[model samples]
Target chain A: MAENQGVLVYLEHREGKLLPIALEGLGAGRRLADTLGQRLSCVAIGSNIAQLASQAIAAGADRVYLMDSPELADYQPDIYLALMGQLVAEARPQVIIMGHTDTGREIAPRLAFRFGTVAVTDCVELNIDNTSGRLLATKPVYGGNALAVFSTDTDPQVVTVRTKAMAPAVPNASRQGEVITPAYKVEPSVVRARIVRRVLAESAGVKLEDAAVVVAGGRGIGGAEGFKQLEDLARLLKGAIGASRPPCDSGWISDTAQVGLTGKIIAPELYIAVAISGSSQHMSGCSGARTIVAINKDREANIFRHARFGVVGDWKKVLPAFTAKVKELLAS
Target chain B: MNIIVCVKQVIDPEAPPSSFRIDPATNRAEMRGANPVIDPYGEYAVEAALRLKDAGGAKVTVISLGSNLLREVVKKPLAMGADELILLEDAAYDGGDSYSTALALAAAIKKIGQYDLILCGREASDTNAGQVGAGVAEILSLPCVTLAKRLEAGAGNLVVERVTSAGYDVVEVGLPAVITISNEIGEPRYPTVKGIMAAKKKEPLVWKPTDLGLDASRLGSAGRKVKLLRLYQPVYEGRCEFVEGQTPEEAGANLAIKLREAKVI
Candidate 1:
């Protein structure tokens, strides 16, 4: 067995490009690796993903491990878990950072269990304890009402970083790195709980997590028709539309657009919350926005607590004027 | 078919944010005046199990582990049509991280010894670790798919519509698998009055660490590999600048003007 050293990032990719969270996690791993005077390495696994190695290298990695196989095209937990287990044994990284994404959520804990350990997940902050030389992960708990700091002594401390919580690694094409193709094999026969089909969500233009501006509604918007009016503002601002849990659960919008603790975590330039009471669960997702504007009839609504600017009125009456004024200001 | 669901009693996450408090001395949260309730996500798990039972003949067994677990809160699942309830109630089970919690739950599950499926919320509202389900699955050496929005039984396997960032994937898994339920499963059906009456008459089976053949080191805080260094509420030090106008419509327009002036667009 090799000595546990260096920081390794588990890179997640869709289609041919890396997810934003992947680069974010890489940037975070880079800080830790540099702080510890260790090399930063990353591994990419999928079909025809040998090309992503260079991308990973550009994103602050000193070395890149590439594993590409047709059977590994779609993320099957078992095959990926087996491969990760083997790689951990070979590289023996001191810390493994993964994005708190769909794949990360599935693989991180299982992999830690294989190592007889536990993973600190959905972390917003990761630090190297100067005294103990251990990884400290701070995460939001109680539906974002409180934050808890945790640390594990086990080797190869595993962490899944929340999306947008860390700065994305700046691509440096001139950065020097090497790509190594690790031993790879896929035995599909050993896999269970396989994905048979996918019903891709119908979202057009900007995504909720990446949008510069987001116009979101809540139960006070009444129903689907009210969301249509919010959509008018979203279009005017060239932003995506989101919702609180009630609107989504009531079928007013896609669950993909729900922004809360259990849904998407977003950090946009501007977030326009219309008639949302701003439950801590909902605010946890968008509190990172640069500016928040709330329009609601109730003056004492929780939404005002988090907003930078507010209009105390029905969204039906307030939104039209807000949209028209924003249109005029942008055009001028 | 037999199904097992794991539920947790948590400080009501719906309580007003002002009521949210933390005891830094003990590194735990104390909801000033709020009562505990069954985790909303766990309620979704119960709903999933109940739906499976509704579709076919199955017995839904509910399990919870904690200290000072309110009977009304833990019995919510039973009122939701579950056939049986098991409680691992003891002080030794408190303060366990996901690792130790999974150990206790898994041990209890092994004692039950008959389960076709295991369901859990994606994460509890209090801790929000989102690891217990997968931890239990790994402990039991079973397959687990997280964040399911829809589920159905087909032949000897299950068809689950697992939620994803981009969309939903149709998954097929054999019997004796674990799945974590998400919010998109839809609001859990309300427990009818008759069901509540029936729940009032039912007494849950309670167990201690000894009953599960486990001891202190593996049961709770002593067994926790991840230590809670500190817990506290994040302060919103900044102030909210309310934009007011003669009329609501003018306020809306002024809000737009303020954004432009701040160059925050």
Candidate 2:
């Protein structure tokens, strides 16, 4: 049997802020490690992420591995992959967990390939096999119409967990853990990918994932003008405007506002699907919303099945009236 | 320049929920009646390649691994102006997972020999596993960049806009790299009648594992590292309560009132 090793969570950060998914990864890592009676270690790789290392420990990590270097900033794939691969070699975590974000999706599979292991991405649930001690990851397949529970016989099972699926590790403030700063050598010449610039897409109101209410438009919304109404509704609800794949593919909405299997998986308190006939692909992301309200001209739209409230009519006429009512209710 | 884009045929992802049927015997999701389409993201990859070809002279060959049933779907990139299409089809290749798929593609890419770049979609819609592109890169020992929203094939290297959490990163990488194109690449261009006619003339060449010299043990389901125990749809408990009213405004107002009553507002 391959040696039972510790669980490692890859910590992701951007603009000096530890991304929310990192804490979620640690939370997931903590659970697996606890179940297996193994230690949980968080690997923080970035420029000046020492504070993040300590926070990781406070947030439930048993050990924190810090690899701080100027070259680590801005996320050059080559450098990050190299450092992470090397860390995995040295640390030898039996189960590796990462968020199924852009970075995690890129790194987990590649790293698993390098190790001759298997990688399962965007897992909504995970468990340990009692007999083999393998990591069993539950992932959605067939566009979320079904879930496949998979397990890898290869050692050091690597998995990427979807956002909002797991609770994040809350800081205890007094918790302590070992901090290991490994001596790693990454020559700049070996790094092939270089980031020359970065620009954030402009967004207004609440961030989609964090919003209490999400007013998402789909292809039925027609064009950018349809999104304008959604934007107005979102603003009235103190929420954010999101989209299904069509609107984003049509360039009517920014990709950041996209919510689906390939896009951001969100679970707002209330999901207002406007003019969107729900496909399994789009509904996969928003199935977690507490209450879904679908407004579409198509009376037979699949979204009505899952929504808490279904308004069967033209969203163009329905939205304005809906927004006015919401406004009146808010004022009252 | 020779560019290869790995494409796959998948069951339509946009199919309605009622169309999904669980085959209790097989424990897999099956559609009652379905039309297969080129994975949407793969269209973006084709678009990315065509854009590169438009800027400079290049031959784009799209390679897809699936059943012979995908012959029509495989011709999509060809209609989008790709120079050639290679379909890796065989009974042995049936029900292969992503790892097997990548291994087969890597073998095909090696057989093609000379290539400046390889492109793929960020993930396949059916499996939703964004691993095959990176996995192929691993087998070939080549540098890979995933989720490229914008790409420019410069001399000796490529510049790209990589999507990140906060925004996009402009990345520079050498040639002979693998790039997984994202939805941010914009809508794939529809084929003109002329292009469709040209595509019909360019027949796809089908190849089996034996052609690539891949053995039975190292290909298909046998090569898979992960074992699937079961497949089932998640049960969503709630059903929508239809709002009926004399007017749209009344219905909308009642929805608000219901939300207020439920204390969700």
Candidate 3:
């Protein structure tokens, strides 16, 4: 590894608050830096983002590159990429790590192209090869049917680590890192697209992607109304309502609530799959969940193989009891 | 105006789950002959571009970065009324992550300059990175609008409805921009028989890295910054206890009992 080249992590923030995944990226990058025997630096860009820079340092960054610009207050791809591209060119890091969140997903690839390098995305695992002195990345493929390993003998490797793939770092409050406030030049003419408004769904709290617990229903739930009981269970448990593709395609649930390869990838602590057959496509997204409980009337449903616990019964019959019990526990 | 729609051929998402596989040696998906479908998201992209082209009287070009299978995939967009096709084909292009692919695509776009707009799917069904479109936009130094659910032509600009967590945001961007269409935009139109016949007679412009003035070292695995180390199936290790009951109320009670025991309720 080059001396000047270190692991540069992009700190993800929104509306002045730092995203948890950004700290996780800092932790993951710190490990990569340690393995490579290099320093770790982080970059935070957005308007009024100076306060969050310290958090990056606390997470493990040796230095923080700050770029505060009004154009970057919201996520406009052109301005963000331009700012990042400029930073990368100046820093010339061997590896640039980012969180696989909405902002990171949008910026990482764009930055990679501008720097003329490939970016491995949604990586679940990462390691450094001591002998080869190269970084190795792993991600799911074929709708989670297989895992593919890849490596490159090149410089400035770009990677977007998936959320929950690595543990978040313990902040070192005493450690104060160097902060470099970079000069940002953004032309209003360059920002052709503007975010005039942002609308959030009413049930946004239970978004499958960020949920800690997900109660999913499938075709076996019978119809659209079937989701009511599942939603009740989810609400009782303070979890999200998820659905298999069958229900999403059948218009029983919105696509946003679908949990599968084609939809959201979730890693909830507790995943309750009701009447789901456990198709590989669907399994790919929920594979990361810590504990899986499957309920189906058909004892032979494919979901049983991957589920940690399964009840051979109708979800309609099983869900009310589960909800009541959960409510009771919470009440206590 | 010229518009290019990037299309990718993917395994039919509706196909049975048992058909998917990966070729270990090649590090490629073993989906050679299974039913091929236009990536569902890409369909929205193609349709969006076609709408733009028809509205603005622009020449729409369909581009694909893949094998000969692209011949079929590209034709679908052409049949939907794309005027021309460009195929970036080469063995070296395989195993390319989003950034590398975007680099080659940017080079191709520069070679085929004069395009006023570029459209892509928000994310492909396979990798689902949703990065390439933004990557291309970055490489080309162009503005990009992501998750555009609705679009209309405006005076020297494009009015788009961008989806966000809250609701929809209406934004306007001038020409020479990249827009990623969401699946909710609309269903992709079916190719008419006449359009398909016309598409059969059209030959795509095939180009390698060399053709687009890109160095071999900067276009493939060699140029990749990140690598995949390993992929393993996650192990599910939870013990499940069945709650037996003959009636709905009894089943509910049994489930309630189990939840109470687990202290999850």
Error of 1 at B54 (Å): 1.0
Interface RMSD of 2: 1.4
Q: Model 1: which residue pairs collide?
A: none
- Candidate 3 Cα outliers beyond 4 Å, as residue runs: A1-4, A14-17, A69-72, A204-212, A219-224, A244-265, A279-281, A296-302, A312-332, B31-33, B50-59, B70-74, B78-100, B103-114, B165-169, B190-256
TM-score each candidate.
Answer: 0.97, 0.96, 0.84
Model 2 CAPRI quality: medium
Provide the clashing-pair count of each candidate structure: 0, 0, 14
Candidate 1 chain B, poorest ten consecutive residues by summed lDDT:
B235-244
The recovered share of true contacts, given per candidate in order, is: 0.78, 0.78, 0.58
DockQ of each: 0.76, 0.74, 0.44
Q: Model 3 in CAPRI terms: which quality?
A: acceptable
Candidate 1 or 3, higher TM-score? Answer: 1
Candidate 3 lDDT at A76 equals 72
lDDT (10s digit) by residue, model 2, range B215-249: 96777788888888888877765577878668876
What is candidate 2's CA lDDT for residue A312?
82
Stretches off by above 4 angstroms in model 1 are: A1-3
Name the candidate, 2 or 3, with the larger lDDT value: 2
